[model samples]
Target: DMYQMISDDNPYETPMMIFPASHYTMGGIWVDYELQTSIKGLFAIGECNFSDHGANRLGASALMQGLADGYFVIPYTMQNYLSDQIKVPHFTTDAKEFDEAEKAVRARIEKLMNIKGTKSPDQIHKRLGHVMWDLVGMGRTLQGLVKALAEIEEVRKEFYTDLRVVGRADDLNTELEKALRLEDFLVIAKMMAIDALNRNESCGAHFREEYQLADGEAARNDKDYMYVSCWKYTGDNEKPVLLKEPLNYTEIKVQTRNYKS
Candidate 1:
């Protein structure tokens, strides 16, 4: 399209490569009004925080969000938390308390290196993207979600067992970094599928095929799912627990959104 715009060629008539993608669909780490996460002193801002937008992010919302957070919001809110830590001492990375933590991280990296697996972190990442897009993205279904869970679990196993890295962990290795990130991404993917499966209702961007109106619109079950779901991670072996905080619309009316209007 950029080429078409600059040149004399027509945009539609010219051959163009296209890639389908979800544009800021519903999902982000939960945070309070001050952009503070459940963990104390930790903050997530802008796109990282799930404070704004209940479902779909409106056009130019990200722009407005960035402006509000960067210029107005976080500067004031973050100070409210930082003022309490004026007397608190900061721990450096080389601190004695970080010894156990550092050891754990090093041990994990060593375990990954010793696996001597065949697949690269990049390869598994692509596979994971496809799995998420096909099974967990857009139109989520019960059967598909269940299948995705199983497939993701298997993929997770494959990562630990047959992974291969280009360089040593102690060196400047992007592959090792990617492997660490992919490990976390796999966890998040599982959580997304679990959230989708448990909801059992279609609301906003989360469209479950089984739950819809006669007019082919999203059908929200306010009675049961009238709340924000908070998932707590227990461990890699155990299922996450679900917590709900009910939403009350005292001033504004809540109802199904008809895009046709």
Candidate 2:
């Protein structure tokens, strides 16, 4: 493992090793050139929105993309949005919508606190991580994916019912925050699994066990699966809508992707 290789305890340091963890998100809220989502008021940029990167993200592009979106895109788009909203009066926090939103947030926190569970939130999170790493971590297959989905379902159920937190609701509790973040990670992990499973061919960081070259290199099926898979989250019970945006390669011709000569 990557962690073990990097650790001080390890005698022989390997130059390259697999360190699988919940890293970058390829898909997020759909956005336009202006970084605006489908909702008129909402705007998402950087890693939060699935805009720039297609299937495989290039190195050193993340910084460039984030800066470009933040400095150029957002400023220009906000100007356009604000131009129309200049005459509109600013709403106060005491407004019904704001009050309702606050109430809902508070209620959620209260509900989480009320659950007197035996297992700590970390315990549940560790199990989730193990499940994901075992089945849907590096290379994935149909059997492994199905098993992972079942395990994830069980973890989610345990998380909601048996998870515990140690802190007052008012104060800044790091544990509670971690628990919330872990919950979000769980949802995100599920989406990744679904995306990986649906995509039968291997491409970029997404490597399917069933699709690979004889030498272990990822084989891209551009003719069939050369499209960005954008998933829209509906709700807890509802299935995510899988949207495909086809890649148009005009300048560069389709060629074999290889790092080694």
Candidate 3:
């Protein structure tokens, strides 16, 4: 019976394995109407900007948004911002700000190299990947999220102590690069858990097991949670603070979607 059904219109076998993983984060650095981030003199576009997609992007929309922002939006908006600065003198690397930024980066690199502990960056990252995949990915519960947060802290501690990176920082060190990237990922993972914990209601890709309806579908709480979450980083190892911008729809009425017909 299964073979007959499969032979009717399907091109592959019935039994198969489906693996899940994060494709892209629709939530990213928030941008304004002009495609500029909150910080002045800096701009972000494409997958890095959060303004295009709400929580979950569908199909080819990511490509379309990227192209439109690159070709149409930024060209005009950035020109306006740059119009007044045309007469400004070019900045030299000898400037204080540049020196400080470079020094900070070098110090961070040295710190990572000096650890010289047992576990490699890849090992710690693999443990982190498991924590994220199991506790924070797809299915989520309050208990699981709390566990993930705690486990992330423990992994972060391990990373700071046991992280081993071979090669010199002055040169191109692939292991150092991975260690740095993993360092960033650790913080971002914590932020994810925090945001997930704050938003008790489920919406888009951020599904919470405690906020489901009788039909096992996500139950959105628009009355209380219709806002974009923004986080402000405060120093090293401190918890990020949250700020919300309420979503306002003037032309469209918010309604539940039905895909079954």
Candidate of highest TM-score? 1
**Candidate 3 Cα errors over 4 Å, as ranges:** 1-21, 24-26
Question: Candidate 1, residue 202: CA error in Å?
Answer: 0.4
Using TM-score as the yardstick, the better of models 1 and 3 is 1
lDDT of 1 by residue, 117-186 (tens): 8999999998898889899987989999999999999899989888898898889999999999999999
Q: List lDDT for all candidates, in order.
A: 0.84, 0.77, 0.83
| Per-residue accuracy of model 2 over 162-191 as CA lDDT, tens digit each | 888888888998878877787787788788
Which candidate wins on lDDT? Answer: 1
Q: What's model 3's lDDT at 30?
A: 77
User: How would the candidate models be sorted by lDDT, starting from the highest?
Assistant: 1, 3, 2
Q: Candidate 1: how large is its RMSD?
A: 4.5
Show how many residue pairs clash in every candidate, following the order shown: 2, 0, 0
- The digit string of per-residue lDDT tens for model 3 on 147-186 reads 9999999999999999999888888889999999999999
Task: Name the lDDT value of residue 19 in candidate 1.
Answer: 28
**TM-score rank order:** 1, 3, 2
Cα misplacement distance, residue 188 of candidate 1 (Å): 0.7
